[model samples]
Target: MVEITLKGITKRFGNFLALDNINLKINDREFMALLGPSGSGKSTLLYTIAGIYRPTRGRIYFDDRDVTDIPPKDRNVGLVFQNWALYPHMTVFENIAFPLELRKVPRDEIERKVREVAKMLHIENLLHRYPWQLSGGQQQRVAIARALVKEPDVLLLDEPLSNLDTLLRLEVRAELKRLQKELGITAVYVTHDQAEALAMADRIAVIKEGKILQVGTPNEVYYKPKYKFVGWFLGNPPMNFVEAEVEGDYLRVYSSRIPVPSHYREIIEKLGIKEVILGFRPHDAQIVKGVGDGLLGEVYSFEPLGREQIVTISLDGVFIKVFAPEEESFTFGEKVTVEIREDRIILFDKEKEVALEYLYKD
Candidate 1:
């Protein structure tokens, strides 16, 4: 296994800056995921590490050796593209064995390795069929098997599960995680899907507009986002943001003013600002039957999602979504009070769009 590092990496396409000055250190055997929306440079960063795209400025290192200028063929990295790029004419066995054959392994060794990888990926039974005859998930498994047959020190996956259907995607995701753990191979994965990254990555690097925004475990990025953009991006229903002003020791949302948690005295004292953004997750706000130390709103709509329900409500002119258990019921236009736990509140600088502090005292 090999640790990978990118230092001061930058890339540009004509007038567009595709990647900013990016730097990251990926530990050996760690499954690091690069996650962002399209045009955010997640794929470009992956290609740079794969030697498919040379950075405009910066260096890439594999373990202790600099490989910024090395050709992809010599980089000893295995890359699986988003498309299952399998040769349609070749049988699955031949496809998986192609890399070993190119490396001049003996015929017996090629057969042995092919069988081993095939079995590990649970595609051993499909070896005699061509890519055209197999399902999308099977073809993806074949592509992965071919990459693994070469025994690369670093594996790079570019949205490897994007082509599969939802159910198949989950199945493949589980298998991919299992394979990575059993092989202990260092991997770098790129994806626009937040759910996939959250479900699969050991640590995720959230990128936006070609710059790294936040890098952390799934929980950190989800619950303790450092920036407003991160809070807006990671969650399903997304975090709710309300325009509010600090009025003395109280925070005013719309016409109602609620006292700030006493524990946050120091943080509030440090901020010393009147205008701020109140950020809280949908799960952090709940519907209550009566008045409470929270905001009052009328339920606008509800979306049922299996065991949980997402309810949208309007406070003043702003809409907020709340996640609740499926058993909870609310009708359209029904009056409801939202209980926002002080400990779960996040305060952000309205101008900078950055988190200022947690609302509650530690």
Candidate 2:
């Protein structure tokens, strides 16, 4: 297994900066996911580690060995491309054995390694099938077998399941995570899908426009983001932001007055932030019938999602969504109270667009 490290890595395409001073340590046998939106430099970062694209500045290391100048073939890293990159003319066995063949392993030994990896990926039965003859999921398994047959110390995958259907993606995702754990190989997976990173990675590195914004476990990045963008980018329906003014011991969000919890009062005072953006997730707040000690809003609209429904409430002109159980129903233009969960509130510096240390625990 290899612990991959990038020290001040930077990449440039002429005047365009693809990566900007990236520093990360991916642990030995860790499943690390590079997650972001399109054109966010995630793919470029993965290829840099694989030795396909050398960085313009900085060093790449495998464990303690410097491999900045090593050729990809000598790096002992297996890479699975986004498209699977299978040769249509080759049989499954041939595709999986190609890497071993290039290294001139004995014919019998190549067959043994190929069969071994095929069995591990459950593609042994499809060894004779050509690429054109297999399903999308089958093709993906074949691609994985091809990468794993060499028993590489580090494995890198670039959105390997993006082409598969929803159900197929889920199945392959579970299998891939299980396979990685079973083999105990250091892995770096790249994807724009938030759910994939949350489901599969030991740690998630959230990137944006050639910069890593945050690196943390799914829960940390989700519930305790360091930046407003990190909180905004991670959640489905994302996090709701409202303009507020700090008024004595309370925050005046539009017409509602929410008392600042004691835990966050000192931090807020220390920062001397008069204006702030209050952020919260959909599941963190609740809607109640009639007026109470909560934000006054009217039910604007809602969408029923089987077990639970997403209800959109209008705080004056601003809208925020709340997750409500399916059994509880609300009608349009109905006056309701939106209650904030005191412990779940996130405070962001309005001018800096950065999160404060309000989540600090006693």
Q: Which numbered prediction scores highest in TM-score against the true structure?
A: 2
lDDT of 2 by residue, 154-198 (tens): 999999999999999999999999999999999999999998998
Give the residue spans of candidate 2 off by over 4 A: 358-362
List clashing residue pairs in candidate 2: none
Report the number of clashing residue pairs per model. 0, 0
Candidate 1 lands at a TM-score of 0.95
Q: Which window of ten consecutive residues has the lowest lDDT sum in model 2?
A: 353-362
After TM-score superposition, the amount by which residue 54's alpha carbon in candidate 2 deviates from its true location, in angstroms, is 0.8
lDDT of the structure predicted as candidate 1: 0.89
Residues 1-362, candidate 1, lDDT per residue (tens digit)?
99999999999998899999999999999999999988899989999999999999999999999999999989988889999899888999999998888889999999999999999999999999999999999999999999999999999999999999999999999889888988999999999998898999999999999999889999889887878988888888788999888888899999667777675557778868788888899999789865556798888899999989999988876899998899988888888788887887878878887777643221
Candidate 1 Cα outliers beyond 4 Å, as residue runs: 261-264, 357-362
